[model samples]
Target: MSVFMISQLLIVIAICFDLMSFQFKQKRMIVTCLSVSVLLTSIHFALLAQWTAAALMLLAAVRYIVTIFSYSKRLMFLFLAANLVLTVVTFGGLTSLFSFAGGSLQTIASFSKSDQRLRQIMMVGISFWLVNHVLAGSPMAVMMESLFIGSNLVGYYRFYGMKLSS
Candidate 1:
């Protein structure tokens, strides 16, 4: 298969990981799945030669792994700072802003104590990623983010019933 096709396939696999993340009630399980998804997404972006997106994804993957162990405010700040540095280093076009915003929000969400709050924040972050995927010309990634939003909503409903408020 061509590189483009391989990248698309990788996105599909990443989508599965992301979708699985929201189904579980435990935060660790969710982060574990997200870590895999982010790592796979990083590889997908690398295959597409979207270096900025790939680098951000790598940072997000590391953040998710650390979050699984401890939701430290210090670590959150460190990751946010690292994200800024990566954005500056990658320094592509306007599209990089979306990745940075998404990554920052996700990093903050990782530190939240409540699952609902995490999901809510993640929805916003995923929306940013959706925009980035559109601007970056990755249709499958866009679809993945869209599905992730829906899945998050469903997961919320499954866990907390119909109430949207935390």
Candidate 2:
């Protein structure tokens, strides 16, 4: 599979792990998913030649180890901080997509209300695919789509300043 496909797969699996955790409220499964996600991240870094993968993997491993051992809030805080850094850095370039994608959020949010765990998975998975798309697609394409649709979800709307909601 392509690196993009592999990354999206990792993202789906990661969100699945998180969804499972939300359903059962178990930390271990989430950590396991985090481990797999981190491993994929390392490979992604090698593929992309970014230096953050090592640090991410280390943080993931540490979070897994501590969570497995049933750690204290301090450790959890550390994990949360690492997650914060990962969240912003990983999604930085795609923020424009999210900022624009907000309009479709009502529809998406309905799913979350239908079932809380399902909501998280959909949100994470779609965001992952979109982030991958925005980052990997041609800059020209991304910009054109974003401007055309007033959102990153270009194909979902009509042409000429029209929208699904109108």
Candidate 3:
């Protein structure tokens, strides 16, 4: 298969992981699946030469893995700063800005103690990512982000017995 096709396949796998993460109610299982998703996403972005997305996803993977053990404000601040630096370094005008915003939201979401809040914040991030991927012409990524929005909405419903209006 072509390299691009392979990368797209990898993105699909990552999307599956992300979808699984949303389905799990347990914190550890959710974060573990998210970490795997991030790892695969990072590899896919790198293969596509989307360095900023790759860096952010790698940072996300690290953050998920670390937080599984313990969480602290210090770690959040450190990772946020690192993510911002990477975003600036790999800036590509508006597209990079979208990634920055999405990554920032996800970073903040990582610190949330409530699963509902995390999923809510992630929905916003995925929206931004959807735009980014569309602008980059990443068809699979765009589709996945769109599905992520729907999946997150379903997650909120499952968690709270209603849509998260907030």
The number of the candidate with the highest lDDT is: 1
Give the Å error, residue 95, model 2. Answer: 9.1
Superposed by TM-score, candidate 1 places the C-alpha of residue 149 at a distance from the truth, in angstroms, of 0.5
Better of 1 and 3 by lDDT: 1
lDDT of each: 0.91, 0.41, 0.83
- Model 3 score (lDDT): 0.83
59-152, model 3: which lDDT tens digit per residue?
9999988877766888889988998999989876787888888888888887777778888788888888888888877898887788777777
TM-score of every model? Answer: 0.97, 0.38, 0.93
lDDT against true structure, model 1: 0.91
Candidate 3 residue spans exceeding 4 A from truth: 163-166
Query: How many pairs of residues collide in model 1?
Result: 0
RMSD of 3: 1.5
Roughly what TM-score does model 2 have, to 2 decimal places?
Answer: 0.38
Indicate the residue-level lDDT of 57 in model 1: 95
lDDT (0-100) at residue 145 of candidate 2? Answer: 26
Clashes of each: 0, 0, 0
lDDT by residue for model 1 (1-166), tens: 9999999999999999989999998999999999999999999999988878899999888888898788789989999999999999987887899989999999999888788889989998999999999998999999999989999999999999998785
- Predicted structure with the largest TM-score when compared to the true one: 1
